[model samples]
Target: MQTYPTGVAAKATGTPLTTLQRYLQRSHITLQPCDVPSRGCGENRGYSQRRIIQIALTTELARLGIGPSRAAKAAFEFSDKGNTGRPVGELYPLGQTLLVGLPDGKSVVINIPPDKSISDVLSNDSAAFICDCGYVVAKVLSNLSKS
Candidate 1:
């Protein structure tokens, strides 16, 4: 198994330390005390390599606009349902326009003004669906990285 210190993981993944903490907290990954003290701190707390990867993947998902809750849910779902089957399509009726796409494909919408954000047209459920899609994509990327 590959191992990485928290600092190294943060640097490699381009994730802030605080964001990593939030993801770890949300994901409920286990951690351990560091054998060596960190710089400018007397405490010795460190995250495991698996935890770092999990946090990094979560951060990347959230960066794509998926919130922590949905990210965790989607990550769990993807882990259980490996991407070996055909894609699933979903349609979102946003006001007068309709957006349609497969879960892992780019969305196509019709009759929406170019200046408006998609969030403006979507209801809370639709927004959540979009967030879940982002998380699924992140999970796929994470799995690819492991191979």
Candidate 2:
């Protein structure tokens, strides 16, 4: 597993440095500890690729007006649900769009058979929101590489 420093992780996850700092302070997220802790202020801790993805998804939830803490919790649950091997981004087909239930703060990835659209399964006025896993994963990976 590749581990990224704070600045790189923040950039990779599209999370602001201060926001990551706040989460670390409250123990919402922890770094994959290093041999020598302090390389500098932002580089003191190292975050894993998994952690970066978690942060990125949390921001996805936050866009729905959910606060950071709640979003982080939901993201954590979604990412590591049941200690499952695959994370959220790869839970379904790479480009699959997931229908997220906001009420319970859980996500369900239903396999969309070929020739069927996601809209075919749910009504238009659904309280649920759709998430494009492919886009999210690509964005995070692309940024992670750049950073």
Candidate 3:
């Protein structure tokens, strides 16, 4: 498998170099092979395809208003669960909502209610975010099966 250096990985994942550096430093999560080395360190950093995907996921989490630390954690957790070297398709983005399938063969769409806007949800302290996308796991499994 080809490995991408820091600049290339950042471009591939649509993540800022500084933000990627921060995650590499603060998050103890081990990306597959070759992650950014510590600041001022001379070690060369590389990113596997899997690590780039993880960075993409982390960027999405950041867009969803998740803090960098938490985003890094969630992205790594998702990566760990899949444990595949395959890259996720570029077509998918973390949309406003998701349709998830349950273990019981049930599917549900999670999103803000029709009456609520993102601003409304953000402004209201009583409002909460909801996400129920188990199909994401299914997709990951499907991709791994192809390998």
The number of the candidate with the highest TM-score is 2
TM-score of each: 0.39, 0.70, 0.50
Model 3, range 54-81, lDDT digits (tens) per residue? 6766676577676666555555544434
Range of the 10 consecutive residues with the lowest summed lDDT in candidate 2: 29-38
Count: clashes, candidate 3 = 0
In candidate 1 the C-alpha lDDT for residue 94 amounts to: 28
Worst 10 residues of 3 by lDDT: 83-92
Predict model 1's lDDT versus the native.
0.44
Off by over 4 Å in 3: 33-43, 83-147
What lDDT would each prediction earn against the true structure? 0.44, 0.63, 0.51
Stretches off by above 4 angstroms in model 1 are: 27-51, 76-147
lDDT of 1 by residue, 1-147 (tens): 344556666665567888766766765433434223246666545544434444554555567676666554443332222222312222123222332232553333322335675655453323233333333334534643654
Encode model 2's per-residue lDDT on 1-147: one tens digit a residue: 457777887888777889878877886765433212456655566676667777887777678776777667656654545323344435554335453555555555444555777767654535445555456667889987776
Measured by lDDT, the strongest candidate is 2
